[model samples]
Target: MRVIAVWSIKGGVGKTTAAVNLAALAAREGARALLWDLDPQGGASFLLRVSPRRKASPRRLARRSVELRRMVRATDVPNLDLLPSDLTYRTLELELNARKSPSRRLAVKLTPLDGHYDWVVLDCAPSVTLVSEAVLHAADDLLVPVIPSALSLRTLEQTRRFIAQTRSKAVRVLPFLSMVDRRRRLHREGCERFAGGAEGFLRTIVPMSSIVERAAEARLPLFAVAPSSRATRAFASLWQEVREQSASPTD
Candidate 1:
């Protein structure tokens, strides 16, 4: 599986939304895509109509592939499935750290699903904990959502540093500007500045839209709920860039 983690150090930057919609679009391409909700809040799981699961302790859960398989919940969308988050995942740092090769435990547990899925997307929690280290090791690419703001860039730099410090895998960091508001000079200028200098910054910019917020309420990806919306088109372009870059070498 081509593992991708949709992550950021800061919350409310549209990470979960990007994860859900990207996975949805991947499914629409006729690929088997599994969305693993690693966030304790279970926002991505909820968006996909998957219920929260009881905590699957990493120790036992890692050894038993059968039990691990049981945790996957199929979504209404075909070619798309989910591994819902658990409430106890809040203590993932403790659970994951106890294991051997701690940071790679998530990758080890997910190995059995390699042949079953064409893609595996992780919707991560917003924190720089042991869990974040595991995420860095598990994914082949880090798909980050960056809002167009001064603080947002700082958070991005922090995340980049963390990945550099702990990665066991050659995970590419793909950052994109999200929740962009063209009406505001701050948003426009920030996007322009990042695009001008950043090598991996995606060309597609997802604008702040009510339709995007409503995707959570409607329990669907932006593409499925409002295909005609400009935000949806932006996501489509983003996914295209993602697919092309996913097959290319990591920077």
Candidate 2:
């Protein structure tokens, strides 16, 4: 299976939203997709209407006491399943740091499910922690959501450096502009400044919209509720970019 991690060092960059929508679209396209909500906030789990319960301790997952297979749960969406998250996940870094080869632990656990899933999307927490380090090693593609701001660009730079330092050069980092305000001059300038050349940024931009925010209240992905909306169409385009990357991904 190809693993995609929807991640960003800064919070509120539409990270989980990207993960949920991408997974939903993957399932709609008949791919067997599994979304793991690794954030303690359980954003992806909540959107898919799955209860945030643990079948096993995440701390013991790397040690083999907690098997990744047992934690798998079905989502209401066809061809999509979920691995829920809980409050305990806030302390996930501690457990991962305690393990040997923690960076490889998540990838190792997912190896057995290679034949079972077409895609495994990790809805990661917003941080540069041990948990994210594990995902950095595990994921084939790291889909980063960057808001139109100088601070966001800083984090993206940090992410690039971290990946380089880890020598996980096989991981393809695809950064994109998200929650962009078209009326803002700064937003337009920021996108133009950082979204091309060697940065490997995507051209599709998701505008800041109320439809996206409503997904949280509707407890569904934007595609499921407003397929014809501009935001949904943006997600579809985003999915296309990722699908192409998955076929022949590279650093």
Candidate 3:
């Protein structure tokens, strides 16, 4: 399965929103998709209206004592399953650090699901830790949502440097503008300056919209609530680009 992680070093850049929509879109297109909620806050899980059957203990997960497949729960959306997260995941770093080859643990855990899923979308928490490093090792693609601001752009560069430091040559980083309000001069300028396919930035721009918030509040994907909304359309375009890139031969 192609693992796609929607992550960023900073929070509130629409990571969970993008993860939910992207996985939903993948399932809508007939791909067997799994959305793993790696955030302790359970934003993706809450958005999907899924609760874990038991507390996701970091110790069990790190030791491989728990079968990931057994944790999988089918969502209301067809062909889309969810691996819910709980507060216990906050201790994941400690558990992983106690193990050998912690960075590879996540990838090893995912190996069993390769035959069952076409795409696995990870909704990651915002931080740089052992867990994030594990994600870097496991993901084939890192989808970063960058807000239209100088600081956000700088954070994107930092993320690049972090990946370089990890020497993760196989993982492709795809950054895209998110929550952009075109009416603001800074937002427009930032979009114009960096949205032009520079530094592997994506062409799709997800505008700031109340409909996105509404969809979250309604606990449904944007497409399911407002398929014709601008934000929904933007996510659709983003998914199309992601799909094409995944199908292309990697360098």
For each candidate in the order shown, give its overall lDDT on alpha carbons.
Answer: 0.85, 0.86, 0.91
Q: Tell me the lDDT of model 2 at 97.
A: 76
User: lDDT tens digits, residues 168-215, model 1?
Assistant: 678888899999998999998978777733656877888999998888
Can you tell me which runs of candidate 1 are displaced by over 4 Å?
53-67
Largest TM-score belongs to which candidate? Answer: 3
Give the RMSD in angstroms, all C-alphas superposed, for model 3: 1.1
> If scored against the real structure, what TM-score would every candidate get?
0.94, 0.94, 0.97
- Cα shift from native, residue 100, model 2 (Å): 1.9
Candidate 2 on 1-251: residue-level lDDT in tens?
88999998899999999999999999999999999999999889889888655445666655755667777889889999998887877777777778788887788788888989999999999888778888988899999999988899989999999898887638998999999997999898876776652367887788899999888799888887888999999999999989987898363
> What range of 10 consecutive residues in model 2 has the weakest lDDT sum?
52-61
Off by over 4 Å in 2: 194-198, 249-251
The most accurate candidate by lDDT is 3
User: Candidate 1 or 3, higher lDDT?
Assistant: 3
lDDT of 1: 0.85
